[model samples]
Target: MALTVDKLINDDRFCGDNVFQFVAFLPFALLLLVARVFLALFLWIASIILPNKSAVRQMLSTLACWTFGVYVKTKGTRDPRCSVMVANYVSCLDSLAASHVLGTISLRKWKVPPFFASTLGIRNAAQFVRKQHFADCPNKPVLLQPEGGPTNGKGLLKFTDWPFQIGNRVQPVAITVERLFTNVTVHRQSDARDKFPWSDALWFLCTPVTVFQLRLLPPLERLDDDDNVFAARLRQTLAEALEVEMTEFKWEELNRGSTATRREPPAELVRLARQVKEVLPRVPMRDIMRDLSVTRSVDVTITNFLEGVTPFTPEPSDAPTPSTSQAQPRYVTPVPTGVFPKSAKERQLSFQEKKAQMIADARKRYIERHGLSLALNNC
Candidate 1:
């Protein structure tokens, strides 16, 4: 009798820790089987029909995550206009947290398959794989976790070929899951179901993780640099962010110019927009201006900022969920979108208010600094 490749691979888990894990994870495995079926059916329908399919997908993803014991919180601020975003792969759940934090501000079409294939959230994320020129498109921003596969948040891998080309800013994201669930071993680099983490039943059922840190690293220095150089800079930033050692990989660095800055509009960019305005006719000036904005905020701050931009968000929605989701077609609510401080004295109060705020901040900083110094001195 001859052993098939599948048998050769599945026949053993090197440590036989595989057996212990399988027995221990029996409950999770059964749950995953049931959940996968349920989610797959729901997501399939959503992928085909739900009008705001992304939201539906996110809702389901969040719900599934809640079912598990994982929840997330973002930590820092991100730039408003930095367009492109990427991150390392830890678990499939990272997709949900990323999308939720990014919200509608980032135009997200479902891209990755297998990991996110079942969710409507990744409906068209595959399109991002190409090197397209997206200068002033009104659509939501795009995101990618370019490894296109999962790995322990260990060493870095090559990113997809976009960071150096797209006119929008490319921001890197860091998701920290306290305990990792990854394949302990790779055989021939083939997709094997018998792997350690991937084999876990609970891995299939997406769970909301505790302490989801959407750490947005600084924007890539340049979008037009050599792919190798651009990737080097990107990996360098991600490693610094997550504090992981980088593993060298094949790369092509290009000398694309810097389109990553938020201020100082490029002359050609302005000219191109002008040409489009002439050729296209009656494009909204405000919308075009919004398109011209720069990007580079981190996930944590971006989340808070978008909430601030969202009109009436802090006050709570004027409408209910199922109802409001239908009525006005929610655009990405901008934090501090259109609300201006009251005119005259109120507007004048801006400086006084900022000064007061500065004083308060200074005092707090002093207290913290003094307290830390006292502790060190005591030690």
Candidate 2:
């Protein structure tokens, strides 16, 4: 049976959506890029001369929204009173998408790259602060991603406590993008392969019209509230509003994708190769391995690719169940829940605490499995 073009186009995951996007909007998308560059050049010149940022910001914001054909659906405007803002990360485009609506203020961090230094310096919009100086920029509100990294819009990762620690009214901004077959989200944890933040931002060119829904919720006051508890509750509020499940995936997992810093391939890639081989056996394993370039050896590659490769055992369909079967899957209770009672403050445990606990637990288990007797005997 010959596979027709129509049959091939029906697979939304790969060629189908891309082919349609290319046919419909590739030229227009290229034109938009040209226009954006021209506008950005003009904005830079105007800023140097006029030194009026509000006007420049408005123009840039308008250009970004128009160039992307962004459709913004908001619940409420950003609270003017709040000095700290926390938003759920969707993609690199989230900043541009929110700029027009939210009026982004300077989000001071420890340090920013030289490339970002000038761009963010337009209105002295972004500041650099060390560990002791988060409050250095008192005029402008600090924008933060409590998730610490991007995720597929369908879910929310664990939230960090940076936003709540500022001791200001924390405004929660929940943003989501609606796409057909192309996922515009730049999740570092996933197999989607864009290296830099700029490349991730420009990925919107793959789709025709990107629809972003930016919702601004009421600000939460830090009155007598613990930072960890506040951070957790704020995350919960955003997760609920965004209609996405709160994921256990940590921020460190996301940073594993940073080519400049990270040394290892994401564990997700290995799982993906296994799933791909199962469903699409015709797909080339060599191609996948080459793209990842994590391990060269076939045996090691296969071991990583297939996480659970065990020796084959015969199973007779008519055989009776064994009474003392240790072969039955050993059920392990969930760490966070099992250790802490429901009535306790487990839900309030911040990402940092949970992460530390997880490391400690892993260490304990390792020590138990391979006892200290070996080291003592060697001594």
Candidate 3:
């Protein structure tokens, strides 16, 4: 069908040859350039005039992404509205993956283009270190690749400088691409000289037909709360999400909490470094401290990290919360009835609609104590 369409477009005998028509239309391409220049200018201007204007930035990002091929997927508990989230950048796919999960409807899209979603926050750019003038714009909560370079599951490379510069604990995520996005990069650069940005080269490459997989874990962290702890956890979680074999040495226990302690280096590490050099080098020992921070053991301290969510925060003292009974068959007391439907499927029942599901409900305490998955069910 596409071949036929192409044929039809090139067939001069038909209404018009698409190839010729496209080239002919170039005479008016300046109009498009003017439009884009203005659009970018207007956005930059509006963003400046309006303080913390998130909606406009979001619209711009969505529109830009709509022109590309991508989307977002979010799981676990997160407030999409949180403007300062840090996440890992895996093949540049984390942004879209999180956006889809956020459930923000795009105000625009291609008539017949790949699915594109976007999670636009603000971008944090620094003042000039050189002579170049830096425009002040809203910071975007984007995915950052801690390992400054790309990693195909080799041991975690020391993270990039962005994590520290951004000052926002990144939401580390893994981008799983069944097929590498190499073509996208190649074609994109090929078109750099041409008027078209070789966007199509990637369009076919990023198509979902062959690209099927879950996004690696997302960076849903508070950077200020715990710096080293969060980054280390994010690295491990990202590795696990991709089913990558992580490297570990003795004293391989993991840190369960979201925060890391300023403790001494593990015995194993100090021992190994000793064997390599008689005199320990006096370098910034942060890396040595970090190596001992997280462990590979299952007993890693995670409980202490996810504390402080009161789903039961009283709705204003005066307002009464209607405690209408849930239609679920109360299993308060498991009275055994041999006749109680041998097949559990027989007892499976539909639940009555819930009016509200709070974000705090997604906490582990809530899930364990209440046995409820506090997520937007329909979503």
For every model shown, what is its TM-score relative to the native structure?
Answer: 0.46, 0.56, 0.33
Off by over 4 Å in 1: 1-25, 46-49, 53-58, 64-70, 104-120, 123-139, 158-160, 180-189, 192-202, 206-212, 220-228, 250-379
lDDT of each: 0.46, 0.53, 0.34
User: Candidate 1 or 3, higher TM-score?
Assistant: 1
Supply candidate 1's per-residue lDDT for 264: 44
Model 1: how far residue 164 lies from native, Å: 7.1
lDDT of 2 by residue, 82-164 (tens): 76778887665666666566666433232334323233421222333423344654445556776655666656777765633
Error of 3 at 85 (Å): 4.3
Best by lDDT: 2
- Cα RMSD of all models vs. native, in order, equals 26.5, 13.1, 26.0
Worst 10 residues of 1 by lDDT: 250-259
Q: Residue pairs in steric clash, candidate 2?
A: none
In order of TM-score, best first, we have 2, 1, 3
Candidate 2 steric clashes: 0
Q: In model 2, where is the ten-residue run with the lowest total lDDT?
A: 2-11
